[model samples]
Target: MRIAALLGASGATGQKLLPLLLDDPRYDKIITLGRRATGLRHRKLEDRVVDFENLAAGFDGLKVDDCYCTFGTTIKIAGSEAAMTRIDHDFVLAFAKAALAAGATRFAYLSAANADSRSPVFYARLKGRTEEALKTLDFADLGIYRPGMIVAERTDRRWAESLLFPALPLLDKVMIGGLAKFRSIPVETLAAAIAAFSMQRGCGTRIHHWQDMVTA
Candidate 1:
C-alpha cells in the first residue's frame, strides 16, 4: 500500500488524474489538498482544504510516499508576476519542503515545456525555478513532467491556447523537429503519464518533454 498526496486535485490535469489513482488498488490512501472541495468521491480519498499562502501549516500531520505537485496559475489570473511566482515557485517549494518534513520521499511536479531558468518568459522561469528547488530536496525520486498544450474542456477561455490550438496542424507541419514541440496534448495523456511515472521506483529527476508526453 502506498500513501499519496495531491496538491491541486481540482485543476484540469489533477481532476483527470484523480480517477486513475482512485481506481488503482496499489494506492491505499490519497490525500488531496486544495483551496476548495474537489467533489470527488472515494473511500480512500481524504481532502484537505488549504490556501497557497498558508500551505505549510495546513500540511501538518500528513505524510505520504508520493507528493504530486500540480499547482499552477497564469499571470493574468494571478494578477501580477510576483503573485504568480508566489504560487508557482514559492508555494510549490513550501509544499515540497513540508512534505519532506512529513516523511514523503518522492515528489512529482507538473511543469511546462520550454521551462528554463534563463528564459525571457516569466512563467517558464517560475516553473524552472520550482523544478530546481525540488531537486535540492532529499527526495528519493523526483519526476518533473513538462507537458505540451494541454487540451481540456474548461469553464472559461484561455485566449492564447484557444487561438493556437486551431492552427496546431499547420504549425506542426512547419515547426518540425525540436522547435515545433508544442502540440495539442490531451490533458488525459499528461495525467496518465504522471500516474504511471509516480508508481515506478527510481532515483533523481525525470524530465518528460512535451513531445515525449504526447507519445507517452
Candidate 2:
C-alpha cells in the first residue's frame, strides 16, 4: 500500500480526484494539504490545513510515497500577475519540495495545454516554468499532464468561460487532428487519469498531452 500526498484537494480537479483516490485499494493513506478542509471523511483520508508560505515548518510529520498537485489560480481571480505567480509557481514548488522531504518518490502535476517556458503568454509561461522547476527535482517518476479547457462546474464564476462552456462539446467534435489537444475534457476523466498514472512505477519524466489523458 502507498501513502499519497495531495495538494489543492478543494479545487475542481482535486475535488473529483479525492474520492477516486479514497476508493483505490493501492493507497492506504491519502493526505490532503491545503488552506482549508476538504470536508470529506474517510478511513484512509487525512486532511492537513496548511499555510503554503510556511509549508516546510508545518509539513514535518507527513510521510508520503507519491505526491499529486492540482493547485492553480487565474490572474483575474488573484487580482495581479505577482499574486498569481506566487500561488501557481512559488507555492506549488514549495509544497513539492516539502513532499519530497517527506519521502515521496513520485510527483504528478496538472498543467495546461500550450505550456511553454518561453511563451509570450503569462499563464502558459508560468505553467511551463513550474513544470521545468519540477523536473530539476529529479524524482523517481514525474508526470506532467497538460490538459486543454477543463469542463467542470466551478464555484468561482468567469464570465467569458461561462459563455464558452456550453459550446465546448460542439467545438470538441470539430477539433480533430492537430487540434485534438485543444478538445475540452471532463474534470472527472482528467482526475481518473491522474489517479491511474500515479500508480505506474515508471522512471524519468513523462508529459501527458490532452490525447494521452483522455485515453488513459
Candidate 3:
C-alpha cells in the first residue's frame, strides 16, 4: 500500500486523475493539497486547502510515498508572463521541495510537449526549466509527462483551443513518425498513464512523451 499526494487536484487533469487514484488498490491513501477544496469525499481521500506561496509552513511534516503535480496556468489566465511563471515554475518547484522534505520518494509532474529549457517560447522554456529543476532533487523515481493538446472539458474555456479541438483528430492522423509526439491525447488516457507510472516502484528519471503516454 502507498500514500499518495496530489498538488493540483482541482484542475481538469487532476480531476480526471483523482478518481483513478482513489479506485486503484495500490494506493491506500490520497492526500490532495490545493487552494480550494476538491469537494470530493472518499474514505481514502484527505483534502487540504493550502497557500501555494507558503507551502512549507502549511504542509510541514506531511509525508507521502508518491507525489503528483498537475498545477499549471496560462499567461492569459495568470494576467501576465511573470504571474504564469510564478505558478508554473516557482510554485511547482516549491511544491516538489516540500514534498521531498516530507518524505516523498516518487514524483510525477505534468509538462507540455517540446519542453526545451533553451526554447524561446515562454511556456515551453519555463516548463523545461521546471523539469530541469526537478531533476536536481534526486527522487528515487521521477516521471515527467509531456503531453500535447489534451482533449478534455475544461472549466475555464479558451476560445482558440475550442476552435482547434475539432481539427485535432484530423491533424493527429498526419502527425506520424517524428511528429507523433505532437498528436493530441485524451485527458483520461494521460491521467491513467500518470497513475500507472506513479504506482510503479522504480529508480531514475523518465520522460513520457505523447507516444509513451498514449501507450501506457
The RMSD (Cα, Å) of candidate 1 is 1.5
Across residues 77-98, which tens digit of lDDT does each residue of candidate 3 receive?
A: 9999899989999999998898
- Candidate whose lDDT is highest: 2
lDDT of each: 0.82, 0.89, 0.89
Query: Candidate 2 lDDT, tens digit per residue, 27-132?
Result: 9999898888899889999988878889775567777899899999998889999999999999999988988898888999999988999999999999999999
Give the range where candidate 3 is weakest over 10 consecutive residues by summed lDDT. 55-64
Any runs in candidate 1 off by more than 4 Å, and if so which? none
In model 3, which regions exceed 4 Å deviation? none
lDDT, candidate 1, at 195: 85
Ranking by lDDT: 2, 3, 1
Clashes of 1: 0
- Model 2, position 20, has a per-residue lDDT of 91
Q: How many backbone clashes does candidate 3 have?
A: 0
